[model samples]
Target: MRLGWYSDLNKQEKRTYWACFGGFTLDSMDSTIYALMMPVLMTVLALSKSDAGLLGSVSLIGSAIGGWGAGMLADRYGRIKVMQATVLWVATFTCMAGFCNGFWSFLPVRFLQGIGYGGEAVVGAVLISEAIKPALRGRVAASVQSGYAVGYAISLTVMPVVFAFLPEDIAWRAFFAIGLLPALLIWFIRRLVPESEAFQQVSKQSRKIDLRVIFGGEHRRITLISTILASGIFGAAYIMITWLPTYMRTVLNLPIASTSGYLAVNIIGSLIGPFVYGLISDYISRGRAFMLFLICQTLVVSVYMFAPVNMTVVLALGLLLGGFQGGLASGLPLAFSELYPTQIRANGAGFCTSFGRGFGSIMPAAVGFASTEMSLPVAMGIFAVSSYLIAFIAAMCLPNATGVDLSDHPASVVNEPSPTEAALKKTPAVFR
Candidate 1:
């Protein structure tokens, strides 16, 4: 099966896969670096827990807007063009964030940076899903999503050295400065990856992006269900991610070095989770695989939070939790993409994922508030358990769209011309 899948991909398709993988890797590193810096930033900026959570929430809000806007644009323009732009936009804003002098200054920079971060994910997922054949879609998309773990690992490994060597004030800034590295990916994408053929085929026939397309038609239920699904998954994920570093250092009284060591084990599990999820998803079905992982996530997170605090025990549970979370996430884009046809796939998938970020963004702040009443772990566990349960229900409600083809338009037709597309058509033939 592996050989068949590998042999089926042409040179262009293979390049597209690697491009999406690389783009997502850099995007994950740039975005997740903030989580690592949060503990330090809190001290340096005199930020209350609420303030820290607000920053995260605001950035996620920006991601939602960016995701929604980018998805619409990807439908009107081409995916590759919008994707390249998002990469540059995020890298530039992230570098600006490195220079911010205070809380107010950093807020806008991070928010702007999040726009590109959000858009890149949408375009990359849509591009790859459209480019590959349906039979390989589950495994390939999951593999691409695995880049998040790789990026997280890269940040986890580098952060310690950067912090240890540099002064505290400069160390945090330096981490943000490293966001500039992903700007180089634009050059790689420009040269290596082609636009999705699926998009190209439907380009002339495509209707302009309208809210009615996804939200007012037969697609509305799927859209609503998808958003709820994304929200639950994202909420649970953000709670763990936004607070894990702080929880380790503050509540557990772990030193910086020890925190890094524990996170390293978790990252290892994260790296392995996607492949396991991919195989399971390919063999069974996407929704079933997601449901299975969500169950594991609920269990592992409880153990990680409440179990005895021995170093070995913590490491083992952390690894398991990471695996469960990572595997659960791997199914999201596949399920979303499989549900929508090519014409609106970008919009549908992007909105669902981005909207999830918007809803999930609240958990960090909620956790911050809840921590004052109870221990951080208990607070996180409460939210996580609820979120996972909601996500499980949503997963069950969704259709089992494991290997559905997305290369064609939907059966229904509404080919209204977009202002954006009309403007694009006005460009000279040479420019086009």
Candidate 2:
């Protein structure tokens, strides 16, 4: 019954794959719930566009912190435990967000909620990357992100139904309450997922919480480049993802059917994109795949933003916009893991994706502030094209790391300090 990449995976790998797939699906759902509700929140809470954008930006910031912290914790404690904890944390905080009355009150809850959101994706991607074979890694890891589109569809499908049955205020709250349901998956994870064999093979005594490992030597160059790469990747995608719903409804004055058509098409494209991108990357090169997607995305976004708005234009280009951009969302986790050794794999990968969000976290607010002057499409075009251009350049800079063997990574890199670090350690702790 198994076909394609699924045919290649054994039972243990399949188990890990499904576990990560479920976690990521929920993570995507919780993240989209905020975006879906931004318009409702604005009407009920008297929030300005900037305020709504701030809420989006803050959660990304929280996710940034959570991701980096989780990676470090995963390296020290264990991936499964930290992943379980993060899922529980996100579910709890997200439900609490439903109770808040204003932006100020919602701020802390949303931010706390984001921490879990960010941690889960980074850890899940890292976990899957560690568990799967190099030959199947791109196809498998990238396919997992298709769950994002699935999550978006779930939110889109459920939101209207919830709103149809309940009062506006109650519907949003009920939707938020639904967030807690992901917590139920933690039981399955605990029972089914085992610690990564790679982690077990490595000596526990050698592990420590040193931050410098990811920032020094061979890691330093890749970390800096990958962070910028991730920033570009996330910045490009999230800028549109965060604000598109609001733009369609508020700026375009889109009738409900038209808006839904565009979003539905876009979502479908996003669902299909990761698989195609993964197949392309596996056969060609990861760097080439990114370069191709980023270039095409820039052109597609440019057209999507600048071209005159009509049902025809929107319908024709909507799929390309979502497919081109959304597919690239997988690039960071798929590509970045090969850049580091096992010990700091999560730490490095986590920081790149998380802090990439940290860097990317700037745009929603920027678009919100810009909405005061320019058209949303204009603002989106300017920033989105810019983001893609940055990503294209980063893609150019990245080493071709496709189908790299993960099992062969040596532990010597983590234990060894670079020349600069060696000199600094010998000096006094404070004065040096």
Which candidate number would show the highest TM-score if scored against the true structure? 2
lDDT of 1 by residue, 1-432 (tens): 467566788888899988888888888888888889899988988887877887887888788888878988998798889888898888788778788877898789878887888898888888888888878887788888888888898888889899889999999899888988877955576567888877777746555777667775456777787888888988998888889999999988998888988888887787788878888888877767888899999988887777666778888988887788787776777677776766777888889988987888888889988888998899999999899999888877676556756654433244442222332344333222
Assess each prediction's global lDDT (C-alpha) against the native: 0.80, 0.82
**In candidate 1, which residue pairs get closer than 3 Å at backbone N, Cα or C atoms, i.e. clash?**
none
TM-score, prediction 1: 0.92
- Residue 307 lDDT (model 1): 66
The sequence of per-residue lDDT tens digits that candidate 2 reaches over residues 27-81 is 7887788898888899988999899989999999998999999998988888898
The stretch of ten residues in a row with the least summed lDDT in candidate 1 is 415-424
